[model samples]
Target: MEFHHLGVATADASGLAALFAELFDAPVAHEEEFDGMTVLFLELEPGYFELLEPHEGGAISRYLENHGPGIHHVALQTDDIEGALETARGAGVELIDDEPRPGAWGHEVAFLHPKSTGGVLVEFVSH
Candidate 1:
């Protein structure tokens, strides 16, 4: 697997994207809105950082309310998402989704629960 990106929950994605631009000298790589959230993707040396700003209500909103703006999850890329999910299950890791689903940039993804991962959410993706 390869590093994909780190997901960050924020109150203002665009504003944070701007800050990241100045900090990294990198422009936004991608932008999208879904599931009551706005996402801004920024390129980094290895992968990217995704800033998630919540709208009315959703996971991001709840995350912010409970933990404030901060890192949400880390995503790793694989060649086979199904195989990765099975490996996680075999290892007795709790999963948010038992099966892979479509994720950003049309990649297949599955999330591992934070409870079993040192309180850090982890996602595996395959293009």
Candidate 2:
């Protein structure tokens, strides 16, 4: 499982992006809008850093308001998302999305909630 991306929940998207730019000397690679989320993807050596801010009012915004900026989830790249999700389910992980869904950047992804992974959200994606 290759490290794909780290999802960061931030109240201020531009502020966090600026900080990353200053620290890593890397600019935002791309920006994508999906459903109710606005995601900023930043390239980091072998993987990526994703800054997620709620577009209007949604789960991410609520999470940020309640918990401040923090790591939201870790995404792993896989060849088969369905196989991974099935494996997770077999192991009794609490999946947020029981089925894989279309994700950002034309990938299929599924999320296992934090409750099932020691309070760490895990996402498996098939490119």
TM-score per candidate, in order?
0.94, 0.91
lDDT tens digits, residue span 88-124, model 1: 8899999999998877667788999999889989999
Can you give the lDDT of residue 81 in candidate 2?
84
**Each candidate's lDDT (Cα)?**
0.87, 0.86
Pairs that collide, model 2: none
Candidate 1: residue 38 lDDT (0-100): 84
lDDT of 2 at 76: 97
Alpha-carbon deviation at 19 in model 2, angstroms: 1.7
Model 1 bad stretches (over 4 Å): none
